[model samples]
Target: MDLVNSFLNFVVPPASLLMLAFSWPTLSFINVCEWIYDTYFREIDMDNKVAVITGASSGIGEQIAYEYAKRGANLVLVARRDTRLRGIAENARRLGSRNVLIMAADVVKEDDCRRFITEAINFYGRVDHLVNTASLGHTFFFEEATDPSVFPILLDINFWGNIYPTYVALPYLRQTKGRIVVNASVENWLPLPRMSLYAAAKAALINFYETLRFEVKDNVGITIATHGWIGTEMARGRFMVEEGAEMQWKEEREVHVTGGPVEEFAKLIVDGACRGNAYVKYPSWYDVFFVFRVFAPNILYWTLQMLSTNHVVRRTSYIGTGRPLYLEGSPPRKFLTAGPSTQVPVQQQLKME
Candidate 1:
């Protein structure tokens, strides 16, 4: 066994490289052909189709609802905040959605997920698209967690939240030959700072859907989107903080958000789902870092560590002096005031840290 293992290990790396080298051009050409087909020849007509979106109260989910609305899709918006959902539903109607239904439910709970999916079926008769956008983010470093017991909220919301709805709606989706759109994140693979739990949950979510896609085959379409930061509440620091941990204003906003506007990202997501694209990436440039993470992981790690250390040193919120320290021009509040609706210039919004 040891001799066989040694021989295979010695041969596999060069063999894999040779295969990739020979296949690269063919793969690229095939991808381009697929892109052209998806772009021009294919489109799932969403007119009057029932589309259920979890986490539709705000952020990318809200924008996605509008995109679907423009295509005349009937919308079922689900969220915990009823008041916010009402406002979103109104805007979705104004955007051209023929019929909009709002449901207030927690995505993490199986009962809530089942109830919403059932109600959506009863109302619309069939679900054409099940968009899972319910996710929770955390800002504090994993080691800084004072109460580790609260950590499961991140996984529960970010991972199981998406899974529950997908499970409950899969049968109806299969009946309609519908699609499942997942709003995953680039952190699924990127080893970003202060997002240990969130990253792990997203990684699990991505892997689960990838496996499910194979099992379901062409019966149910799945579009998994992985993008970087947008101008969402999460980007504004409305993340899950560890209990007993102080909320500090970190000027690391730029470090976290380096993607395009949520509106643009949402448009692309809906279009890709309608076209049955397997993956959708916003800003697209983030794809470059995957190569770094794969071929030069040490370099990626060192660079990330350096960036995190620099931000930590310049953190303006609290410096362990017992009391909070607010630097000049920094807000004292824990959460930033940038709402998801606040539009910034596209060029400035896409600027990297």
Candidate 2:
């Protein structure tokens, strides 16, 4: 490996320069033509379409339900919180949707994911789009981790959570030549401090879908949505510790919120998914930073270091005070809540009333 690296070090730079010189114009032209094609030919119709959305209880997911509802699409909303899901479904109906189904399921569980997708198909008859918008975020430095063992929760929820739903819904989606929209984050490709595991999961998500896109080869459309900061429940819900290794989750409090509105972000995401866009970067400005990440990594690293300082309030456990409990492989922690809840199948949390 060392010898291969040494050889590449000697040859890659010149070869890259030559390749860039020869391919730049062709690549630029192709990009221009692709943009034109997408702009003029791409069309997305939401009326009467059956759409399945995970993480539909709150944040961008909740707003996405409303946006799709406004377009007259039938929706199946999934989340761990049945109460919140019910509320969002009601709002979606008021927005314009004639039919809305709320299914409480954890995306990380294969069976739960299967049930969610199966229930959606059973209700709608055909599925036009499956939106994977479920994710979790943390803001602690790696060194302060009390139990690095608990880090897998991050990957399981963010990466595997997206994958499980896509896997189960693929067959139904293929029937309609349907689309899959994944809510990845800009942190996947960019340098961001204190979010190492979250970024890794997102990066994995991006790579997985990118590869899946070619494997499906026009059979199923895949749209990867990459977003930066947004004003949402996750933004204001911060974490704090009482003492050594004992983690305490804090209440949602606004402490310098920065980002675009979740509602607008949701609209853009829906529009992009329906248009079959390969990628969507929110706030538009994230594109510039993404470019800098590739070409000017050092500068990007320094900037992110500065940006992460605000999160370094104190040293606390990585997993938090909540004892890591995977109830039948599902974490005991409440979904999107700092407080813990009793063991129950997430799918049964719904109340039709």
Q: Using lDDT as the measure, which candidate wins?
A: 1
lDDT of 2 by residue, 90-109 (tens): 89999999999999788888
| CA shift of 58, model 1, Å | 0.7
TM-score of each: 0.82, 0.78
What do the candidate models score in CA lDDT, each in turn?
Answer: 0.77, 0.75
Superposition TM-score, candidate 2 onto the true structure? 0.78
lDDT of 2: 0.75
Model 1 whole-model lDDT (C-alpha atoms): 0.77
Collision pairs in model 1: none
Runs in model 2 with CA error above 4 Å?
Answer: 1-41, 238-256, 290-292, 302-318, 321-353
